[model samples]
Target chain A: MALDQSFVGRTYPPTDSYEVGREKIREFAEAIGDTNPAYTDAEAAKALGYSDVIAPPTFVFAITFKAAGQVIEDPQLGLDYSRVVHGDQKFAYTRPVRSGDRLSVTSTIEAIKSMAGNDIIDIRGEVHDEAGEHVVTAFTKLVARADREA
Target chain B: MTAKIAYDEVEVGTELPAQTFPVSRATLVRYAGASGDFNPIHWNEKFAKEVGLPDVIAHGMFTMAEAIRVVTDWTGDPGAVAEYGVRFTKPVVVPNDETGALIEVSAKVAAKLDDDDRTVRVDLTAMSAGQKVLGMSRAVVRLA
Candidate 1:
């Protein structure tokens, strides 16, 4: 079934703030085999002018995607969770996310389209710091494959 | 953060050093835990196969992270990246084995997108198992 077009442009309330942690950043970097000092050492990050350890660019995806769950799990949205796959992703940053920053994300449905019997949705997540300053905006595209029975 | 690579020193077509990252099932499990994306297709071979995948696969975000290292390693500052994007073109299949999969990433300066900010656009290619896994992968970096 095609998603309701009315959901387009709908925005969800901001999620509870998630504090960016130094250790989590280190863990994520290590998982990806990235040994960048800036991810693990505050001093190294400071050398780059960041007040503390900064997360890798894609670190905020974990936060934003979780926030998008509000839309994905919306009872009326009618998206089949088991059939969806990440199709595309993009992020534009105002600044690198730093350790100790309390961040929240506001997710909005940017667009919805049905093509070749597949449902495609574009979601935009706006991330902000505790100070309510814009930090970064993430655009995610998810595709729900056509039901096999269809 | 200022990039170690001076913008003035680089031109369109300047190649960033290429890198190859290995992704075992353990790597996917670690990434899943760290990223909070416990999608079973990334770790459970049976579930992945049932879901129509050949085998357990790496998370698309994991591949995206690995692909960006070429740019960050060149800049010497992860913060220098202003924008990044990628399209998941294919699944990175990881069979249960000591050596699972390898993602090869190579990038080049695609264009000088800005003058005052000293920013340039980088085009990246991510390949696995002789197939392109990411399409239209690119980054906009602010360089010193």
Candidate 2:
């Protein structure tokens, strides 16, 4: 199915706040084979100038992907979730992600297009701290590769 | 807690040695288990082709994780990485074969950020089948 161009510029509301936890950070670090002390020890993070244990750079993916679900599960967008492919992801950070920080993401539909028998949709996620400070802007491109005649 | 490579010992254009990581079906499954993301497209080839994908593909995050490992492993401490990001440019197609699959990755000192803090930023790349699967890759690390 073709994407609804009318939904091109829609902006979704911010998702419920997600609290970062040290155990979660440690789990993520272990899963990625990263034995960084700052990710597991609050004292180590303090030594490095953070209020608490900091998350790995890619930890934001969990937050952004969850927030993006609002846009993906929207029937108004006419997207076939089964046909989607993850094209690209980019993040611009104003600050690092820390374990104790509560974060929320506001997802916006950045672009919608059709190319080479594929439908492309770009969703940009703006991650902010509990105090509403911008932390990172994560961009994700989802491509629907279904063979459809235009 | 810090990188072995000193800021003064390396030039801005020095390339970190490239690495090739073999991605077997088992590895992808292990990644799915670790990440709590069990999307069928990464493990089920039939499901992938039915959804218009060429075949079962490696998770984008998996590739990014590998690329970051190249940097963090060099620094000897994941905490040394203050910042990092990547653009997923292509899908890594993983076929269910004996050789499984493979992705080749490499890094370079893209930029030198000399602050009083003793750190430098490293940029890296991960590729499969000659397609640039990752881009705009940047990492900030504290040096010894």
Candidate 3:
């Protein structure tokens, strides 16, 4: 089934703020096997001009993706979660995300198309700090494979 | 904290040191836990197989993170990256064996942007099991 084309340009309300934690940043860095000091040590981040330990560039993906759930789970969207696969991802940052920052995301459906019987959707997540300042914009593309028998 | 390569010292076509990352089942599990992406295709072999995958695979975001290390390591600052993007061209399949999978990442300065003299665009290639796993991968970083 094709998704609702009207959903394009629909923006969800900002999600509740998620506090970026130092330990979570450390855990993410360690999980990725990146031992960059600026990711784990406050002093190192300070030396680099950040107020505290900073997150790796992709750390915000978790939060923003979760926010995108609002769109994916929309009853009107008609998306089949089982057939979906991530297609592409991109991020543009105003600055590195540091620990102690409270952030929220507003997700909008950028585009929706059907190609080769596959449903492709583009979602854009705009992240902002507690001060309502733009932090980063994450673009995620998801593809739902068409059923073989269809 | 500061970039090791000054903005003035690098130009187009400057190649970054290549690095390889090893991915095991445990690594995928840990990444799933940390990133809050508990997709069955990334950890549960049975589920992955049932879902038409040959084996458990690394998360695309995990691969993206590993690929950007070349830029971060070169700049000596994790915050140096201003923009990053990648297309998931292939899956890095991690077999449930001891050897696991190895992802090799190599990058180069693709271009110097005109709007920002302090920033340059980097092109990256990531390969796993002799197959390219990411396409059109690139990053924009601020240098010292």
TM-score of chain A of each: 0.98, 0.94, 0.98
- Name model 2 segments beyond 4 Å from true: B1-10, B17-26, B49-55, B75-102, B111-123, B128-132, B135-144
Residues A28-78, candidate 1, lDDT per residue (tens digit)? 999999999999999999999999999999999999999999999999998
> Could you tally the backbone clashes for each prediction?
0, 0, 0
Worst 10 residues of 2 chain A by lDDT: A87-96
Give per-model TM-scores: 0.99, 0.80, 0.98
Ranking of candidates on TM-score, top first: 1, 3, 2
Query: In model 2, which residue pairs have backbone atoms overlapping below 3 Å?
Result: none
**DockQ: which candidate is best?**
1
Model 3 C-alpha lDDT per residue in residues A1-25, reported as the tens digit of each score: 7787888999999999999999999
Tens-digit per-residue lDDT, B48-104, candidate 2: 888678999998898887788787666655556666677778888998888776788
Model 1 misplacement above 4 A: none
Return model 1's CA RMSD, one decimal. Answer: 0.7
For residue B105, model 1's alpha carbon misses the true position, in angstroms, by 0.3
Worst 10 residues of 1 chain B by lDDT: B45-54
lDDT of 2 at B125: 81
Q: Locate the minimum summed-lDDT window of 10 residues in model 3 chain A.
A: A73-82
Q: Rate the local accuracy (lDDT) of all candidates.
A: 0.95, 0.80, 0.94
Best by TM-score: 1
Quote the lDDT for A28 in model 3. Answer: 97
